[model samples]
Target: MRRRRAAGGSGAGRGLRRWAAAAALVALLAGCAPREGVEEIHYRLKWLYNVSTVGDLYALEKGHFARAGLRVNVKPGGPERDALKELELGHAQFGVASADQVLRAAAKGAPLVVLAQIFQVNPLQWIYRPDKSPFREPADLRGRTVGVTFGGNDETILRALLARHGIAESELRLFSVRYDYTPFYEGRVHFWPLYINAQAPIIGERLEKAGEPIAFLDPHRWGVRFVANSVITTREMLRQHPRTVSRFLAALLEAWREALDPANEEAAVQVLLAADRETPEAIVRRQLPVTRRLMVPEPPAAFGRIDEAAWRETEEILRLQGLIERPVDVRSLFAGNLP
Candidate 1:
């Protein structure tokens, strides 16, 4: 990682001032609010409006957060948004981030902590027209051209998967991918990274119309369990407003439970369609079930249950890949003490 000039002096001073201002503003606003007044909060998501954010969208639309006395302004994230940075700047009190983002931010001394684990199964996977190339097993990747974002978590995951399966780096062609999925559509890239529920389904429908079937290769299914999206907030926010944190989490988790329930499938899809108008209605409907499976794959386990083992495996993979020089204790970064 290249060192920014802001590492010290004026830059460091500015950052501290911003953080202090944010903290003070939160305290002042919280203290002055009436006992029954709804406290307005901002939530920064990991990506743009999509099915991946159905739980959040549902919560907001269904008045779950309102019942908890919180009026949250849900913000959309994209390639330009950094949830952790927004948290530090006090732009957002809470946000969603991946495990890799948390680990990297902590290594740089960011005062962030995990509030809840949303995705039990990481949806990051490679989608391919199985009939075209037939990616039935990890061994099939050999001699194939695979696409991964050069510095994204998917790179770490794909590398780990290859290493675990004893596939030499020299054997396969690794292609660095951008926002475009043209290569995959053109069949130049055999496998491409995408969220299983989001882009995969959209592409699958296109292939289906063209007489092709799509299948995804998940690292988690192959034993590389990287943690996915989780709720995050700054240490200062957690320390200063314990009740707010608890209420927010409770309502949010309950919202996820309700959204994933089979009875609420139609309502959940409707909420998502409202939030993401570009996604076809039928595609959003298809995505909801796949999103539910990834969010709460393990039965008997409640929604938002933090999988400590998955976090540990995520850290271990980063360490092996030389991403984290000194492993930050995964347990310490969690807000809820995991047993």
Candidate 2:
């Protein structure tokens, strides 16, 4: 959904915008040619530029990938992009995709392997205005209009949440969400799905300005934990270019660590703003902390660490939802140690 802008007088916002603009220029020049002996690696993302991709941008801008002898072409993904399809067609050496996509691809005999888990907690959550018919529990969803992306992961997750709480589909209204947030803005929908870090800040800002504070209904908190974005590559690439995989993972993990570092907050946010000019600087600055929390949920949580249990749960959800007819050996897809 959409929301109005929130006013922020922080000087950090202006500083980041300037740095981001300069960094964009530098990246543009750097993309013109590869450094000597640097192998070109095409990495496709799951979606467009946002806080979700700060680590990827950080790695590119700070020479992390170049330091590993690779010139990565970080491509943005959208409705027209399918990372797994590109990987199968030999278009991209590496890409980011959700766990469900990997599982479904594996079930269909695509030799995809998970390299590292990006989000420790899934960022998909239903946002609602507390002043506008707040839901205290899952059963409270009965008779409420909930917006979900039809045939998307959110649809599956929301269904699972309903089943978990013994709430039947007939009791609630399931509205298909799209790029247009008119229905939500007009108060026709009680809750809407959005990436907590990407769209949440913008929606929350707008709603807050209208005197309606936004709150999120996280499925993870209610015991239905769906896995989010993770790094992926084909088994062929991992086996043939084992060295490249190792180098890429090392650099990538290091970049993620840097992006989540408190000292590097401004730098990371600036990189994201440079990549995605559509999002306001203030919104991006607010998203960085949320991204950090999802990336590293707790202390001693290593960056890029794969949570096996969460993977299993994701597979189960897909199977239960009949998204996949047969079970995919999700654990076998990972090589385990990541740098």
Off by over 4 Å in 2: 1-38, 337-339
Which candidate number has the best lDDT?
Answer: 1
TM-score of each: 0.90, 0.87
Predicted candidate 1 versus true structure: per-residue lDDT over 1-339, tens digit per residue:
422222435554565576667666656666666753227888999999898899998899999999998989999998788787788766788999999888866655566779889999999999887887887789999999999888788888998999999999789999999988899989999999998888888888888898877888989999999999999987777787888888888999999899999999999988988888899998888888888888985768778888999999998988777776457788888886523
Cα error, candidate 1, residue 277 (Å) = 0.8
CA error at residue 132 for candidate 2, angstroms: 2.8
Per-residue lDDT over 236-303 for candidate 2, one digit per residue giving the tens place of the 0 to 100 score: 56655677778888999899899889999988988988899998899888998988889885768678
Top candidate by TM-score: 1
Alpha carbon lDDT of each predicted model = 0.84, 0.82
**How well does candidate 2 match the true structure in TM-score terms?**
0.87
Q: What is the clash tally of candidate 1? A: 0
